[model samples]
Target: MNRALLLHGRQYKPFKGFMEKTKQVWLVVFLFAFSGRVAAQADTMARQSAFRVFLDNDFINLRGHGSDQAYTNGIRLDYFNVLSGRRGLFSWMPRAGENSVNTTGVSAMQVMYSPEDLKKRQPDSSDFPYSGGLTASYSLHSSNPAKKFSLRSEITGGVMGPPALGEEMQRMVHRIMGFIEPKGWDYQLKTDLLINVDFTAEKMLHEFGRGAELVGGANASLGSMNNAASVYAIFRAGHINPYFNGFLAQTNAYRGSKKLFYNIIVSPRAELQIYNALVDGGLFRRWSGRDVSKANRPTLTASELNLGIDYGFALSW
Candidate 1:
C-alpha cells in the first residue's frame, strides 16, 4: 500500500503544471492509449509490469574555450506489461517475451537549460540551449536474468520547445521582487523546435559480487538536435541479480532473486562529439570571439569530448 502511494506521488510532481494546458493533457491521454513509449525497448516483453516511473539527475560537460556545465532533470513513465498477447490496443503488433526482454512502450518529458539562460538576457553572454517538451519511445533487450552478458538497446526522440511561457513567468516574478535583469537584448529559448533521435547499445562489461553489474555501451544519435554524431563509452551500475535500469526495468530472469533490493544506479559516460550544430556561444554569436559585431551564430561540427553522469532509482511491485 505504501509503495502504491509512493508511485502515485512520484508521477505527480513532474507534471504539476500540465493540467493548465489542454493540449498537453490530451497528449498525455493519447500517449497512454496508443503504441507506447521507448519505441525501441518495446520490441520484447520482459519484466512484465503494467507500469514503472523514475527520475534522473542528468548532467552534460562541455569542453573547449568557453567550457561550462549544463544540466537537466528528467522524469519518465514506462509501460512494460501494458500489452497482452493478441488481445490489446496494439493487437496487430507482435507478441514477444519468451526469448528476450520486451518493453511494450514509454512516454516521457524533460526540461533542458542552463542556469544562466534564466538570468536577464545578456547580448554579451553565451547562448545556451533551454527548453522543455514531451517524448515517446520503445526499448527492447535480450538477456537471461542474472546472466553476465546482456544486449540492451533503445531509441528516443522528442522536442523541447522555446521558453516563451517561462520567460513571462520569470519577468513577472522579478517585477514582484523589485529585481530586474539586464536589458538591451532579446533573450530567446535555446531551441525553437528540436527533434532528436538517440540510440544506445551496450553489454555487461562485468559483474560485482552479489550486488551490481557494470555495463559498457556506445551511443549515437541524429536528427535536429544540431548534433551530427555522438559516440560514447558507458559505465553503468545496477543490481547484480536483476540487472535493472531505472528507465527500463529488469527481465523475468532477474525476478525472485534472493538478493536484497537497494535501488541506485550510477551511469558515468565519456562521450566524443563528432559534430555539434550548436556550439561555443550557443545561439548568441557576438558573445564569442573578438568581433562584437559578428551577427551570425556559427554552426560547429568540430570534435570534442564530454564527461557526464546519470543517477537513477527504480521501484516496482
Candidate 2:
C-alpha cells in the first residue's frame, strides 16, 4: 500500500503541472485573439468616420487667357460617405470584385453655356447656344483593391432652360465681378425635364514602379439630359497612392505617419456623342409662336464625335 501511494503521488504532481501549463497557454491565446478583434473593430470605425465633402466651381473667366464661350460657368457640391456594409441598396449595384469597397454620394450641380458674342441680342446661329442645366444626383462607387478596378453608377434628375436659373446665376456673377452683362438669354432652350443615368468603369493597365501607373476606362450616359459614350486612358506619375485604396483610392491612411501626396495626370479621351439636351434642345420641342425657320432658333437634334485631352496636377496632404 505504501509503494502504491508513492507511485500515485509522483504521477499526480506531473499531471497537475501539465494541466496548469495548458491553462497558461490557453490564456495567452485568448488574450491575443481578443486584442486582434479589438484592433479590427477600431479599424472599421476609422473607416466609417472618413466622410468627405467637396465644393467645386468652374468659370472660364477665372483663367486670364480663356474667354467666356462654350462652357462658361459651373458649380457643384458633393457629399460622400463610406458604406459600412453591402446589404441594402448597395447590393443592387454591380461589384468590382470580391474585395470591394463601396461609397455613396449625393451632388447638386449647375452648368451654363454661352455663345462667343455674349452682348449680341441675337447671337450668331452657328455659334454655341445659350443653355443651362441644374441637376441633383445620387451615385455609388465600388472599388476593388485586390483587382485594381473601380465602377461608378449615378442617377441624375433636374431641369434645363430658364427654370435652371442659368441666366440669373450668370448675370448675378457678372454684376458682382464687374464684367460685361449677357444679353442673349431670350433665345435659350425652352424648359424641359432632365433625367439621366451614367456608368463608368476603370481598370489598372500597368504599374510603372511605385510612383507611376496607367489606367483605362470607359463611360456611358443615357437619358433626356445627355446620351454619350467615351473611352479614356489616364497616365499618372509622381508621389501617389494606389488607385483602389480609399475615396476613389486617391488617398490612404498609413499606420504611423502622413505625408504629402501629389501627381501629374494626363488623360486622353474619345467620345461618341448621341444627343446633348443643352445644345440640341429637348427631345420634345415646345413652340413659342416664334418662326421655326429663324436662324436664331436652336435645332432639336444633333450628334458628333469628339476627341480631347486633359492634363492636370493634383496635390493633397
Candidate 3:
C-alpha cells in the first residue's frame, strides 16, 4: 500500500507542476494584451466601414514549417470599423487569406505537380483554412507631417490548416538522409496565436521634386506564439509615400498626394523569439506540434531576417 501511494504521488506532482506553469503562460499573454490596450488612445479607429481588398506576397516567414519562399502569394479582404473617429482607436478582424501560407508557400522553385495532382491533393495538404484575428489601432494624421503617427495593437490567432508547408513526418528517417524530399515540416497541429502591437510615426526628412519622401518611423512589434514572444522591427522607404492606414487600409500603400496612385514599397525586417517555453519537446514542433512526452523534445526558439518589396495602388474617397 505504501508503494502504491508513493507512485501516485510522483505522478500527481508532475501533473500539478505542468498546470501551474500553463497558468503562468496564459497570465503573461493576458497582461501583454491589457498593457497594449492601455498604451493607445481611449477611442479606437473610425467605425466607418472602409473596406479594401489586397493581394500580397510574403518573401518572409524565414522560420515557417517549410520552404515556400518563392511561391507565397494570396489575396486578402478586410474591413475597418472606426471605434472612435480618425483620432479614436479602431478595431479590426482580418483573415490573412485562407491557408495563406500553404497557398503561397508552394515551392515554385523545386516542387512540381501536374494539374491532376491538384485534384489528387489531400485535404491535410490543401491550402484552405478557417482563420482570422482581431486588432485595435489608432492613427494620428495631422497637417504637420511630423505629428503624423499610426499606433496599432493586434491579437491574432489561427490554424495553419495542415502541415502542408512541411514535409511528411513518418518519413523522418529517410528525410534526414536527404533521401525522400526531406519532409517533416508541419508534424504538429497547426493553430497559433499571436499578440502584437506596432507603433509607426513618420517624418518626411527628405524629398525630391515630384519624386519621393525619405521618411523614418519607429516600427516596433512584440507578440507571443509557439510558446515564445516574438519581436520585429520594420524599415520603410522609397518613392511611395506612406500614410498610416490604421486597420482600414490592410496592405495597400500609396502616395499621399494622389487621389488614385501606386507606390513602390521596400521594407526590410527582422524577427526573433525570446523567453521560450518548453511545454513540448522538439525544435520543429510548434506549440501544438510538440509531444507532451519529455523524452525527445527540448525548448527552443527561432530568429529571422527578410527584405520584401511591395507595389500596389490605392484609392481614397
* TM-score per candidate: 0.51, 0.73, 0.37
Please write out the lDDT profile of model 3 over residues 17-118, one tens digit for every residue.
333422111000111122110011111233234444333222112222222221223433444443432222231322222221100000011111111111
Find the candidate with the highest TM-score and give its number: 2
Which candidate do you rate higher for lDDT, 2 or 3?
2
- Output the number of the lDDT-best candidate: 2
Question: Scored by CA lDDT, what does every candidate get?
Answer: 0.38, 0.65, 0.28
Residue runs of model 3 more than 4 Å from their true location after superposition: 1-49, 55-75, 81-146, 158-186, 190-201, 226-263, 270-301, 304-317
- Compose the digit string of candidate 2's lDDT tens values, residues 129-186: 7889999998888888988889999999999989999999989977875677889999
Please state the error at residue 245 of candidate 2 in Å.
Answer: 1.9
Scored against the true structure, residue 126 in model 1 reaches a CA lDDT of 39
Q: After superposition, how far is residue 87 of candidate 2 from its true place, in Å?
A: 4.6
Q: Which candidate would rank higher by TM-score, 1 or 3?
A: 1
Ten-residue segment with the worst summed lDDT in candidate 1? Answer: 4-13
**How does model 3 fare in lDDT?**
0.28
Reference-based lDDT, residue 90, model 3? 33
Better of 1 and 3 by lDDT: 1
For every model shown, the clashing-pair count is 19, 0, 22
